[model samples]
Target: MAGQLSTNSTDHAHALARQVRKLRETRGWSREHLAIEAGISLSTLARLESQSVAQPGFFTVGAVAEALNVSLDDLFRSTRTNPGLWSAGYEGRDIDSFVASLLDHGIDMVADVRLTPISRKPGFSKSRLGEALSQAGIQYTHLRALGNPKDNRAPFWDGRVNVGQARFRDILRSAEAQSDLNRLTEQAVQSRVAVLCFEKDEERCHRKVVLDTVRERIVVEVQSLS
Candidate 1:
């Protein structure tokens, strides 16, 4: 019998994520091709492989299953089921819950952008977040150019600078920010990627500002990790 993914009913979303990746690789398709077949973007596929999202949305999960030529039941056949833990939204930032949430949502990567990616709390720092994300089955990348400061200044997105802080759109036009975004966009084309920063709420951070703008220009989805 072909091996079926045990989405049976449990909080072991991480293990299931591995199955998803394995199945994807077995088909010998790149993330971009899988995304196209699944009716999703390359970045979304990347997010699922790297993160342990427990209960991905229907379309995302269904699309992946279809692309892989696997039954949804096979993809989600679970040997374990733990409803209590994954039901609530994320709790305080050991980032345990948030990490789990990303796993559930099929978000596989975090591109850290805190100006100085350190944390007074151990888990909040760049390295720690990377480690935590890795443990949760997600990938992490820290782009210095994506960090705040020069990227956050006026005319951040484009040369057309309006009075006040530069919006996310402005920064993308800067040579440095633009280059970083181009790289990220290419990666996103091949993997699932998110802009990770200190502010859990992307609305307040430049990363989110940048992401919102990216959504406008690309086939992208901005999901909150928290």
Candidate 2:
């Protein structure tokens, strides 16, 4: 019975891995993007997808489901039999374009990591943006804690400001930042979440700092959508 149980578990893990790969491929997403979205370590995702891990934990599996915007049951079922799931990170374009992009990518949640959620852009301000997203059946959350400190951000500015990877590395060492990152990870584990900020170029934005920090602890694939 013990041997049989072990064998069953292994089979289940392999099946789940296959399903994960299929869903990712169907949406033209890379492993890195899926890992970031799922808020799991890239190494963990690699092992799970490669069937190197005999049994991934329940929470891990559930996180992957949430990132993919599917239920736990869906992960175990045949991909053809389950609803298609997709998610991607997006920079806020015009309200109309931004909302359209979210809908286009099947993103249901947006994690705004901007220091200030207020935007001069029409319909992109916190209140208006939330209403717009709600009407489109998408959820919006502002993670102000994830924003880089104003002092830290100054060094990155030039003709065009860039997010200093080294500076971000130092900021993430703080307990407070780690706590906020933990919260963001939890959110990502619950649904299809996009990390949002003002800068259209992800490299130029501090939102990338948050994403990179999360990537260190959990394997995740990240993409920049302008």
Candidate 3:
């Protein structure tokens, strides 16, 4: 099953790569220009064209398709199916595009699991982000208790993800975190929700740990939104 899933995912990536490259060249659009118009990073565009990304996120592919003046179905003509519940990161994305992606996915609420709801990125700081989401008709809640402590985050950043996840599991056992986890689980059952973090890769992000923990208490499907 895993192998089949892997093969299907690869096929989707290759399909998107082929269409993106062909369409971009046909339209005479530079990679940088397309990336700028799509509000995605240059590296992401390059990786897609090179067919090097293992699992490109839905929003990332959609943005590229839209930038090239094509439909998503035209770019990825596949039978791949994914869950509605999602997780997202804004590592190298513009705030507008990030929020737009969430809106496109029909996300009604965002569970911010950042330990400190502060960001160096404009429009990402706690207050501004909440305001922006509110204006966009999306609800935002900062679940600080679910955040991984700074001390435990070093392991993840240092490529010691297992160590970080182990330590974060201990944090998840706390009363406060458990309470918030219950809330998150209940809310997820009621609406489309995505946990927010800073890392582009789910494996490196503590939110993956949080989502895994949430899965233990409830059944839900999760996909990453870039």
> Which ten residues in a row are the worst by lDDT in model 3?
1-10
Better of 2 and 3 by lDDT: 3
87-177 per-residue lDDT for model 1 (tens digits): 1112256566667566655554566656677767657676677777775565566666666675444443344333213554554567887
Output the lDDT of residue 158, model 3: 90
* C-alpha RMSD values across all candidates: 13.9, 14.4, 13.0
Task: Indicate the residue-level lDDT of 135 in model 2.
Answer: 56
Error of 1 at 57 (Å): 28
lDDT of 1: 0.58
| Tens-digit lDDT track of model 3 for 150-172 | 88888999999999999899988
lDDT of model number 2? 0.65
Model 2: what TM-score?
Answer: 0.56
- Estimate, for each residue in 1-226, the C-alpha lDDT of model 2 and write its tens digit: 0011112234455446656776787789988999999999999988877667876889998998999889987677642221111223344457888877765554545777667777778887788888887655455677666777777766555533544667777777778777767866654444445777776666676776677666776656565553
Q: What is the TM-score of each candidate against the true structure?
A: 0.53, 0.56, 0.63
Candidate lDDT values, in order = 0.58, 0.65, 0.76
Q: Residue 2: error of model 3 in Å?
A: 39
Please identify which of the two predictions, 1 or 2, would achieve the higher lDDT against the true structure.
Answer: 2
